[model samples]
Target: MFSTFARIRTLYSSTTFTNNTSIFRCIKTIAPSIDQCSNPFSGKGSCGRSVPNDDYFATIHHVSNIVRRDIYLERTLNKMHISRIVNSELVYRVLRSCCQHGIESFRFFNWARTQHPQYDPTTVEFEELLKTLARTAHWETMWKVVQQMKAQNIPISPSIVSFIIEHYGKRGLIDQAVELFNRLKNFGCSQTTEVYNAMLFALCEVKNFQGAYALIRRMIRKGTVPDKLTYSILVNGWCSAGKMREAQEFLEEMSRKGFNPPVRGRDLLIDGLLSAGYLESAKGLVRKMTKEGFVPDVGTFNSLAEAVCKTGEIDFCIDLFNDVCRLGLCPDTETYKIVITAAAKAGRIDEAFQILHRSIEAGHRPFPSLYAPILKAFFRRGQFDDAFSFFSDMKVKGHPPNRPLYTMLIKMCCRGGRFVEASNYLVEMTELNLLPMSRSFDTVTDGLKNCGKHDLAKRIEQLEISVKGI
Candidate 1:
């Protein structure tokens, strides 16, 4: 029996550990007869010292446990394609079992080196395993696995390089992404537009505009013409750095060469000017947009409105808002939110309320974003009557409270000692089939005690008990 496994292992090495089908057949037979050695090779290689029938029975029983676990965990859960919520310990258990049983585990390095394409070292499905590992944020484990593959001199593909760059970028590890990129280039992975774009986008995210700009120039110097999206990434980086003038120059350069860049280039120019308090400069560009038959989109209007509003020039914002409407454009909820928010910030609460009301009457719905500054302003000025009334109106209009809304309302009620009112709202919540959640209960419980309503607090506690079962 020991001689048989040694021959099998020899056959395995010669075939690069291929699934010959004959090997599994031999294992299926010999595994049940393995009374020979629990410690294969006396403690080292193939088979150990002689043992009895009960020892074989015990080993077979242990193999049963291992096989059962792998079938349920790695084979089943892994086959289901859901890695996140799946118990990682269970996978480790199954892998441990396989490794101990001299089996080729999923965790093993030479998993797919075989004659069959499906079991090939360079197969696409094998690559999917790496992709899944990278995507699931198992970077360390994946790095080790890829390195082991490298130790065997497997050809690392372009898509794998792209995968690494994207994984680091999405995880917001810019330096790690750049490091991986450098490593890829060092390994002679020819740079593609896709690779350059990934690195440029990552730099843009970290506000490393100058670095991204320098890389674009370097790529051009290397005769690797950056794509249109690469240019857009640089423009976005420039907008982040408040260098609207350079962005505009790039845009002009693209236009002169007949390269059609994104419409968002103009939008970024507007944002940079608006953010830097250059209202007139921003407006001049907007006018030029219309002059060039480039209808300013919703984003252009938003920046214009925000810039005008920042100057406490609501009148100009209103004019700009009308222009946006005149162009038959629907402003996003964020744009309307900014209008009211800036007004409320400037203590023009009345104007803010008027805009909010007009927005609603004009077929615009209340967005949760607009409520923050408006809520803070109203609460600061002791305008709960209006605030709670607006709250009621929002619900009646079929808009539900978001997390921030509930948090703000709870705080306001607690500060104002409105326990009775808070408890009443819970009743309303119950009526609407909305359970008073943890936050509600927290507010009410604290509010009642703070207000010296110990009896009411007891009742609220009882109500909590009644609802817990639900």
Candidate 2:
């Protein structure tokens, strides 16, 4: 909801902002009244005379844990190290404070870094701050830190080493992140799960199928059993790669390894198959679940039915409805909706009527969603009378049609040259607060245009524009 552009522009434009002012601005913006804390750092006594590094860290450990921005501000105010406060401590405190709270601290920390450009970049403490800032998604600050670090000796943590790589990896910085990975490797810190997951996720991100697969193999060899999350990543990556076969195989392998993959796995496979126009194949996968010693529950059927209908398989879904009855599985509301959708799509008016009748006989109460298919079914058959009748039924059931249902019915009425009925729904759209979208309005306007009703169209256009302002 926030614009990073505004913040970045503010950073680049500002000058003469010293660390104190920069930090104050940050605290003001992020910590909000951090200066008002009763325990504010009385900078004089907060710092000590010629303090050793370990003692400093030990004494301030409690301070470091202070998550309240007000407390941090109080500490910041009083804890100016007399020994020329190192850049690392500066960055780390700001970062630790932010991490304890949120990314809001970046504003203060970011302002702090830029205001002091002439500060030694190679100072070990400075490098630590830069790395922490980057880890918190501060890319603008990260690059500045990296350039300065390269210009001198700044020892980045092995964790920051990996984090820097990932920062680049996410923004498609594969080559640069790899270079940093190599640099960190020379320091004897090997790739860990976070490292591999970062690379795998990155490669999977841009569909670098071959590279991600190679990393998967490397991860397994290093004794990293792919977590359920990892498997899900691989599945989606495989689908994006147009290698459904591999996704299916990977799912089987995960199952064999005793990873009771989430129902989402089945969802992915069925959805992928349906999208590829493999309705029969999708059904086969669903059927196979039962044979694999996992009982196909209502959810399983619902997912497959929805997938089948979504992929434009109306007849197949209708057949599934009858088949489900024979299998003694009582269809739920979702199942009925799926079957009705298929009937509507296939324009099987008689079949849709039969299904609707059967749903009533079988005690399936109609919901608003059920109207999507039934309304579409009537519209497909050019039955404006029947469509309105069902629309009335929805109101009686205390489930008035929503925007989508309204749009569908309006389109049907307009296409069949029923401008009067279409206008009724346009008013209904306003009364229900379901502002018809641009496309929905277009459908109505087109109908009104054909019927030569400019005045009515203008009214709808006004409603649409007014809602956009809101």
Query: lDDT (CA) for every model shown?
Result: 0.61, 0.60
Q: How well does candidate 2 match the true structure in TM-score terms?
A: 0.46
Number of the top candidate by TM-score?
Answer: 1
At residue 78, what lDDT does model 1 achieve? 30
Off by over 4 Å in 1: 1-193, 199-228, 237-246, 271-295, 300-329, 357-376, 402-404, 430-455, 468-470
Model 2 stretches with alpha carbons more than 4 Å out = 1-198, 204-228, 236-256, 264-312, 321-338, 350-369, 380-382, 403-470
TM-score of each: 0.51, 0.46
- Tens digit of per-residue lDDT, candidate 1, span 80-189: 32222112222233344443332234433232232112222333334454665666666776676667667767656777777777777778888888888888855557
In terms of lDDT, model 1 sits at 0.61
Q: What would the C-alpha RMSD of candidate 1 be, to one decimal place?
A: 19.0
Q: For every candidate structure, what is the RMSD over all alpha carbons to the true structure, in angstroms?
A: 19.0, 15.9
